[model samples]
Target: METVVGIEDTEDGKFEDSGVDRSSSALSSPKQISNPIVYKLVRVEGDGRLVPATDDEVMEVGDFLECENSEMHVVADTGQSLECISIERSSSGNLQLECSEGTAEADMGKLNAKLQYIEQILQKVKEEEKQRISCGSPVHSHLNVDSQCSADKFPAMDGKVQSENQEIPSIASSLNYTHSSGSIDQCSRPSEGVIESGSSASAVYSNLKPDLSMSDGEICLDKLSIRELHELFKVTFGRETTVKDKQWLKRRIAMSLTNSCDVSATTFIIKDNKIVRKFEEDSSGNLNAASLISLENMTEEEDGNFKDSSPVKDCGSDDNRVVSETRLGNCSIGYELEDENHQTEQRAAKRIRKPTKRYIEELSENESREHNPRLLISNKSTGHGHVSPTSYVRPAARNVFSEVRIYVTRSDYLGGSDVQIPCVSRVRRSRPRKDNTSLMKFHPTGMSETATKLSNKLLEHCSDAGSEIPDNVLKSRMPAKFHQPASSEPAKEKQCPTTGTAELRQELRPKRADSCSHTSDDDIVTVPTAKGGMRRKHHRAWTLIEVMKLVEGVSRCGAGRWSEIKRLSFSSYSYRTSVDLKDKWRNLLKASSALTPSPADDGMNSRKHGTAPIPEKILLRVRELAEMNSQVPPSYSSSNLAAGAGSVHGRDRSGYL
Candidate 1:
């Protein structure tokens, strides 16, 4: 047949254009259609055509359904839309949908009632706070409340029923008040029917809801989170809460409720001021009066206990839970031998126990030593900026010291313990400049032997704890000193060689023979070599006696004639070159300028200098020296006279005979 054919490239890349009818093959292959639902189909392609669709008519989700001449289109309804088919085949055949036809606001009276109730509760709580403030008791007033109620049968808020006031004994211990201890008791009890402990606890226990429910069911108090419970405590007693100690918080809340008489709960008894135990008195109210008179502590089953030193008399009623107890010995810090009668009285008391461990001793058993933070006893006040009887035991400074010590003592570069924390990646940079630049503008160019010796001693101890400087670096920083004797004959001096750091650091290495012959009098003379040569210097120091001799020679020979002075007095100083003599005299003049008192301070310095009595012989010599210069007879101030004969001697130097 000469008919059109569809061409498609096969997987092998061959174009197959066969002239054949694929419709016949598909029809003969059995149409894979499952049970299909019937729909009334209307064709809108040509003229108006409406036809009932066969049961097998193809349909699927997203196929557009449009009413003729309408702009809207909805997805084809594929799921069972017929009520008869769904009812016949499904298990939820009888399901009837109930739609809410009215708005929730239509029931205003019920909502308003709930709002009013919540407002009233908040008002009551606020009023209680105000009263506490007036009475000098904060909401966070007392560490523990003292509720005057019968045992277990806590009065409910509605006053209609009673519930058991209960908690595990472990919780009592965790109410540790880890920070401080205080009792500003003036805590008012909740009104009758204010607390529904059993129902509230159950509700909170079951669902742990915080928000108030608007359902028809009665609203119950929610289980407080650690923070919420802490806030409750802080507002009630002004006690700080430890967020980390969740165990302590839950117990504290329970204890607070137990102590409140207003909550109509059972009273909690304190043991040795450490443990909080429950206290149950008789309901007849007779025991309340007797309790005031009696010094004996109360006793109960499984919960409350207090120490009683009072003699036990049989009440004859089985209701009295007190049992005569015997103790083998005492574990108190300062226990004394008991008197015969006193011991007998203790023996007769209705206190019974198996002689168990103390509270602290028991606590030690459950906790491991490794996991605990060191707690040193702190006797000082907490100093929390409160004018209250609060003395909290804070975490001591020892813990901080321990942590810092651990960090400092780390052996590796990474400073890692169990977990690895890499050391900071420092950038590669040149070494820091450590050579100290002199601060003074006019530092001495040279020092006498005494000054040099003193400076050496001081420099030896100049080690900074922050960064230790190497010995070679320190030695390199010291200026070269000259100690030469002037002489008529000139002698060649050995010069120091310019050495690298490795050679200069010979002092740091093992003791070795010095290769350089640079002797004691060799000064670090900077001689200009040809050009572009490193400067070389020799090590030497000037002595005080040599300096004094140079001064005397300068005074005798006059300052300008350096070679003559060097030959006359410094003859034995073979190392004293003419230039060295001149340099020495110039420094002496500079030093004399510092020693000479300022002109303005002359009169004041005279009286001040009077205390330093100079020898009469020195004054006579000064007068003798002055006689030779009678041409311009010098007038000397007391300050100049007190400065010594050097100032006087130098005074006539300009026209010395």
Candidate 2:
């Protein structure tokens, strides 16, 4: 008989070969296999520390060995367990294992205690889900009914119950109800529900809402291109619209002109805006009168016709119109009338002319004729009018006055006794005489004999008195030597009696008597003689002492004439000399007197009081020596002698020596 072996049972409840042929063709062939199941390696430690395991290592739990390629559940050590629910192998050789539902392994009693502790947490999650879907609306309405029904039963069913009833070995097994081959089923699937749930969360983050029209209809902000929207925005609103206001204005404009026709069909007429049309019509009739007047004045000045008629009245006239004709012609006679009138009036007025040299000469001649006379008198005629009428006429030979020897004294009685005799005779110019004999005859003497006798007596008295005789008597008493007899024979025969010889003899006799009488009175004659002489009478000679006394007396009396001093008399000549000498002596004496010592007489000592006494002896000695020598010595040498002598004398003579 052949030895037979059956398959052993694994702890995961799968078949496993206990013994098999070695190196045989049967060993290479694939045997029967179960569906892939993934398991979860749950960490039941208090901390989340995991034991690292290698992909090639067979994970062993309490009594089971996890299959490397199958989904299984097994209990592990170190407070952790492994449940293999599904297995996946990537192209890169990465092994992925997923866990089954309700497959955890831990201390059963402790896990049960933790499950009781998490009872409130389960209830809170249920409350949150209920609040999320309040108002009888499900949060995800498009979710598949099977998946939602299964997920809804999780909170009511315990882990033990789930483990016995439905064992979801992996996330892939659980997701198989809604997916296929790792891709989500879009048809009859809940992907939109999931997406909408996430979208609601995103909308809360960005504070934005989806537009229902964009979802239901064919509209999307993201689908609209920038160029299409820009044109739409400009047409609905304006070209210059902002992004924020553009939407609003576009909506309003779309509502207003939604049916507007295209403007490209016909030519568009651009009518003026209301303001421009109004301004044009108003400005047409507007005119400033002042501006028009100013323009007229400007034209008048430019044409050189500032006084032209007002342009308002002449604005439409042809004469006032500015033409091409030259305006220079209008200024030709404008100022002629004023200039001609001035010239004509100027021509009618008279103008004074300056006189010529010939006229000046004629006037000068007339003035000369009026001022100076033609008749002129001579000096001879003027003298003739002053001549006396009773002047004598004499013969040609007797025209010369006869110098008769007649003696006329001062007492001559020619006119009267007191008459002033003509002591100085002048020749009279006589007229021509008829008889030469009468003219030659000497006229009777103008003095009478009695007068001649009295004059002789007077001359004798004057000589006796020794007084100065009058010059008139001396001249008259002298003889006139020239004589002439009459031209008759009898007058010629007699001598003329020697005209003044008798008179002289008689005058000489009285003069001799008067001289004899004058000699007898000596006092009278000599006193006058002494007065007339140049010599002075000696009363007392002017000695030096007397001269000094007089000077002192006169000085006390003040400056006066010497004659007024009763102490002395001086002759006229000596008196003047004496006065001058007194002045000189007083000056000399003042200098000498000032040198006298004071009563204290302390000249020998040094000037303890800072004062010097006068040196009287030295001054007197110097003066006496000067008189003897007749020369003044040098003041320095003299001053030394004076100082020495003053000292000696002051000691010798106490106050005076």
Candidate 3:
């Protein structure tokens, strides 16, 4: 780099004849330049290295003399330049010149040497990273070390790590300037001293700037554009990326450069209109511990001894704890690898729940049906029992499952006592109505066989014991009066010994045992068989007493209140419903209107067919109630007779009144 300075040609170099004396005198005593021309100062050291000058270092025309072994001189483009000006002490304790029409070139060799030094440091960093990776150090540990190293080396940058490419030139330029509060002082150029002393440039370059301040070590990579970051990324990682996200690019570049798992801190991120700072995570304490361990390992590796590398002997007293920590680190690494693999391949699969019992049963049933339908059918038919092959008659398919009784024959117990031992059936769930109907339809033959077997057993027992049948059962077995024996009586009589077992069973078996005869004797009604699949409700006839109570109830409660009548009067007659009372009342009303009373008969009247007769007064009371309620058939002529009867009754009641 070169700097331009403007100067006035004072007296047109008038002291040329005595130039040597005048130049020596002007060099000894300097004067400030008083020209209206603008000048840019480039600081040239006594050793000949060039750097930019600050405002305070630029001398005015009348500054005082200050020099020690270093003299202020002017080197203008025109060889015969004007007078020398002011002099001042540079902060580095060297003399600086403020002069007219001066130009100088920056020392490229020194800058190149500085750049090489930066590259060497970067190379050392890469080598250390490779060594850490080779020694089985985790990426997170490397990141933590990088963070700490960065914080220590560039304490002023606030985690803002820039690429070496951007940092090297700045570092080289900053090398010439020493940090100071007032002004940047120029340091002595090493090449100038070595060259003046007749030393080789190699010797000068070998001993680089020892005075370079760590305070000037900041590199601002956050200001880099996406294209620059991409280039940096390629240079650092030897790869290419299509991602345009600035944060991701910066993070990738930083990680590649540092060989770490973490990015630089959020404070260093560039905030612009397009890019904004998001949430920041705090530095983990684990990272710090890992970093310390990593640093210790590196020191151990460098020293080539592992025994003395422990930093906290008292803390990690147990070797097992160290082993456990290593195990935990390995586990974390494994988990990270697994997560990466999962992400790279596809998302993790959802966990499945165990099948429910119903589902398993359904699945099993379906499998059985698909593979062996007959096995499923047999299992259901036998109700999970083993059916004997000899008696396993394949029953018709039923909608439900039920257990069947399979009696063991007498032959099986022939060697034992003659007393029969009943086979106990397994308890099962009650079949639904539909299942019951289906069972009846499916196994009618089985039922018939059961009935025959039971009858045979009873007959054998009765004959063997010579027990007489009950008189009532014998009476029931006797033929009805109208049931005539057919002409084939001899055939029936011939077959009497072998009559069907069902008929024999019915004839022999009484409904109740002798001990329960008392209950059986009380109004034993045999339900007449109906043709319908469902039996009809038995019709119970209303008695004279019930009719009298109903009439009394009607008189007290008025008519059409059968529910009230039934609740108050016929409460004990559970079989006599309110509907039955309503029906009986209707019949009584019709009978009252139809039956003409003979004047001789005033008491209870009986029908020709004998049944307990309802009293005439009760019938008359029912008619009176019906007439009073108007819900009955109107007996127009009977009303007149009723009035005459009422008057006659009134006349009879008059004497009592």
Candidate 4:
């Protein structure tokens, strides 16, 4: 295209011009401003080719320059333009200049080239993403990042990222964006470099910046907007804006209206605001990596290879707990539970002020839960093994995702076998599936001696606890008619795990003997499975001692402090969670009230069919407490009735009110 406007000869490199012409087709982007946008600067080499300009290159107004063997000159200086029209940095950091038509064309051309390249890359990426989604591959999950500049940061910038775990502010934030420091920078425009052929210049800056103090490159203050800069910072550095940043991001707009050369093409392709380019290659046309320029999308085979070859990093290596560092479409990360100290350090390093008490508590709880499987089996050796369900029924907490860590426990299953696999612990709230008919299907190799021992302990524990169930409720506790007329079968294979503070971890190898017993088909309680589905819950038989402990705690603590009571008594039964204590207390109160014989006597009697069966001694203590705390009945003297019209609190010589 011909020059939008040509000056005869600027006096001392000054524009002898007025009226900021914004309608000119030459401006890359026209917003009716008086100042012209200066991207990066370039020099008209002795060979007439455009070479990169440095941040320190100072171009005077009307300075002569050239691109593609054609002569060009500085058209305007941003700082000294007009009284009502001076150049200022857009939040994006690009200089906002008034349009005069002569300059924007070059910028628009570069922008167009970059846009086309990115669009091509994006189209390819979209297809790949669709393929992955169709194949049911997990989309990478986003981590809870601190000091992160997503929606809550850089409100003035224009870019965003997509996270499976978070709501990033905008798509514009996802662009290969970055920012710079310092104030109203200056840029000079060449008088004749417009490629009047088509669309405006697609000029923008690369996220990289060189050392400003050591170069003879042309000096232009052109760069990406502040928003773009901040985004680039987060993506590239894995951090947000700092107080004293010194980034001098010189402009690297896609070359336009000029000869294609080493200085023209970007060293990297910026697709979806990410650096899709290879690091080994510069802006030269020859790239070290070949797939970048290839037209076809990467096949699943290639993706598999890429993922396999990608580096694996643990979170402990960094300031935070990074479970997985996915080098994918964007800079997304994954997280796992960290230690309290590590958590504190991460928060402190980030300077975030959120309260982390609950987080720490949760972490500690998870650590405790990690050892629950073995602990639960070992706990079968307890005082109330046959009485309290709390002894065998472990307390479950919120579901936690822990890496399977297998222990070298001796088991008899699989005919003296040794295998390595993680023992994953998950607190399942639902019942085990009743459909599993064969123990061989579950056990395969049969449990080892250790497993056998655990099963025996569990069986004996259940039997002992069942004995205290007062015989009458045995029918309801066990629905299976053929449960050995001898009261022989196990407690409740149909038991559903209760949801609470229980750490129900499953061993890699389980006991099959618990299943292949003489129990009826209906009594075949499937042990809890880890993955997921839903099954039946067996009632926990509370021992008389456990009931007495609940009564004592209630009497001493004045009720409502189940956690404290649990801590004081029944401390050995780690399975007895605060919720269990509370539930048992409520049941004891009900049973005491039900067995009590009205106002005639204290509620100390025990019924044969009691849900919350307590010992007589404990029942008597409950009655005592009830009496002590009971409100006194009002006096009913005849004088009081006569004086009921008078003051109820008044007393006379006869001691009547």
Which stretches of candidate 3 lie above 4 Å from their native place? 1-531, 534-539, 602-606, 631-657
Tens digit of lDDT per residue, candidate 1, span 510-562? 11112112311132344466865534343222333344455545445445557
What TM-score does structure 2 among the candidates reach?
A: 0.11
Query: Weakest 10 consecutive residues, lDDT, candidate 3?
Result: 178-187
In model 1, what is the error at residue 315, expressed in angstroms?
99
Query: Which scores better on lDDT, 2 or 4?
Result: 4
Question: Model 2 misses residue 229 by how many Å?
Answer: 28
Candidate 3, after superposition: displacement of residue 626 in Å?
Answer: 1.5
Report the Cα lDDT for candidate 2: 0.18
Q: State the lDDT at 407 in candidate 4.
A: 10
How accurate locally, in lDDT, is each candidate? 0.19, 0.18, 0.24, 0.21
Give the TM-score comparing model 1 with the true structure, all chains together: 0.16
**For model 2, where is the 10-residue window of minimal lDDT?**
261-270
Model 4, C-alpha of 168: deviation from truth (Å): 65
| Full ranking by TM-score | 4, 3, 1, 2
Q: Kindly list the per-residue Cα lDDT of model 2 for residues 111-161, writing each as its tens digit.
A: 222221112112222233234334322212211111121121111111211
Supply the global lDDT for candidate 3.
0.24
TM-scores for every candidate against the unseen true structure: 0.16, 0.11, 0.18, 0.19
| Preferred candidate (lDDT higher): 3 or 4 | 3
